[model samples]
Target: MAPATQPLLRAALLLLLLLLATSHQATGAVVATELRCQCLKTVSRIDFQDIQSLKVTPPGPHCTKTEVIATLKNGQEVCLDPEAPLVRRIIQKILNNAKSS
Candidate 1:
């Protein structure tokens, strides 16, 4: 190994390490944000006939509010307000059906 080139080689290695660390932190921040929430807005009501399916996600460490996502027959999804009276009644009905089964 030539002494004259040793410093340049060390500098290149340090730069590479710094780049890697910065990218790792950026990627981690993206992943953390992705896990935080899935719904930003909620509607108080939806046409019952248009709904094809429903997904209910209870509050957890990632979010503090209960999320109700409905997939319409036309393939569009919307978030329903869990606190709405109609939504609450529907949820209770579904739970009762599940329990009876």
Candidate 2:
């Protein structure tokens, strides 16, 4: 290969590699967004008092968020963040009731 041609080829290869990396990242973001959308379809607006069971799920490999799964009498489960103040209060209330019972 000619000396000047080699530099141009190297630059083109680097640009292609960078574009591939960026497209892969964008694809991952789209997948994540789609997953979240699918999960949301199972969730509805739930009142705190209607929660039949509030279970805490610790963060795992796939799900990094510590979630509180609230099951209602209608068999719908809504995911909430454990760190949220209102969720914490509801969890505490449930635990206290359990203890008294």
Highest TM-score: give the candidate number: 1
Task: Report the backbone clash tally of model 1.
Answer: 0
True-vs-predicted CA distance for residue 16, candidate 2, Å? 31
lDDT of each: 0.69, 0.56
Q: What TM-score, computed on C-alpha atoms, does each candidate reach?
A: 0.59, 0.49
Error of 2 at 44 (Å): 12
Off by over 4 Å in 1: 1-33, 99-101
Model 2 worst lDDT run, 10 consecutive residues: 24-33
Per-residue CA lDDT of candidate 2, range 1-101, in tens?
88989989999999897555433121122111222221222222346767778767565764665656676666655666566677777878888988999
Worst 10 residues of 1 by lDDT: 24-33
**Residue-pair clashes per candidate:** 0, 0
